[model samples]
Target: MLMKSSKLLKLKFKHQLLMLFMALLTGTTMVSAQELTINGTVVDESGVPLAGANIVEKNTTHGAQTDFDGNFSLKTSSNAVLVVSYFVSFPKNQTTFKTKK
Candidate 1:
């Protein structure tokens, strides 16, 4: 009886540890999905910054306008996919970018 009790306690401890590990893994995965930023630059055909260009994520409200130097930063999640909309010197252009999971 004593031997069996010890074995049961060990099994329970192992199960608890396994549960803890799985919880940690799930948390990490979700956090990674949440913490993501999409960064890019908008330049003209002559390699100059195109200020005031609109960078938008399609089907969502997240958006950012290009800075004076054509730099833009937009925060997003793992499921976010950007659809940039802007007008350059030539015409209207649309671009797509995906956030890393």
Candidate 2:
């Protein structure tokens, strides 16, 4: 009688282990947030695309600047907290990023 119970316990344990394995393989038990991408263009007060406008992600080391066409691309985990600065333009502090759709 005791032997039969022990076998049942081991079978239950094996089934639990199998369930865990399947969950890991299928990512059913785990989920992650979607990443964000920031695509923007920098312009001056005159509405002209400002080339070389410095765009830096605040608190983090990642950064990028505008090209000659004033276009820039940045990637982050979510809504990017950025610092946009340029010699010709006012220093933009704590700028909220616009996520691309």
Candidate 3:
């Protein structure tokens, strides 16, 4: 009688521990939002592709450069801000709004 109760208590404790471990594992994997790929082309006001432009994720070291056709691709969070710059003469404060498909 007493022995059976003790065994049941131990089993319950083990089951609780297993559930806790699973929760922790799942929490870590779900802590971050899925990264998104942003593809765009840097163009001048005159509608010409600005090749060799720098596209940087604001406040982070992650960045990319435009190809000869002014095409660039970056992987970042959905709410990230990108800083684009070409030659020093280019206005660095030029702000572009995000577009959704």
Best by lDDT: 3
TM-score for each of the candidates: 0.54, 0.58, 0.67
Candidate order (TM-score): 3, 2, 1
Worst 10 residues of 2 by lDDT: 28-37
Kindly report which residue pairs in candidate 1 clash with one another: none
Query: Residue 46 error for model 3, in Å?
Result: 0.4
Q: Which stretch of 10 consecutive residues in model 1 shows the poorest summed lDDT?
A: 92-101
TM-score of candidate 3 to 2 decimals? 0.67
Task: State the displacement of the C-alpha of residue 17, model 3, in Å, after optimal TM-score superposition.
Answer: 7.8
What lDDT would candidate 1 get against the real structure? 0.77
RMSD, one per candidate, in order: 6.0, 4.6, 3.8
Q: What is the lDDT of residue 26 in candidate 3?
A: 90
* Best candidate according to TM-score: 3
lDDT of 3 by residue, 1-101 (tens): 99999999999999999999999989877755445778989999999999999998888897899999999998876667888999999986434445475
| Candidate scoring better on TM-score of 1 and 3 | 3
Ranking of models by lDDT: 3, 2, 1
Tens digits of per-residue lDDT for model 1, 27-66: 9988876756877898877899878888766677888999
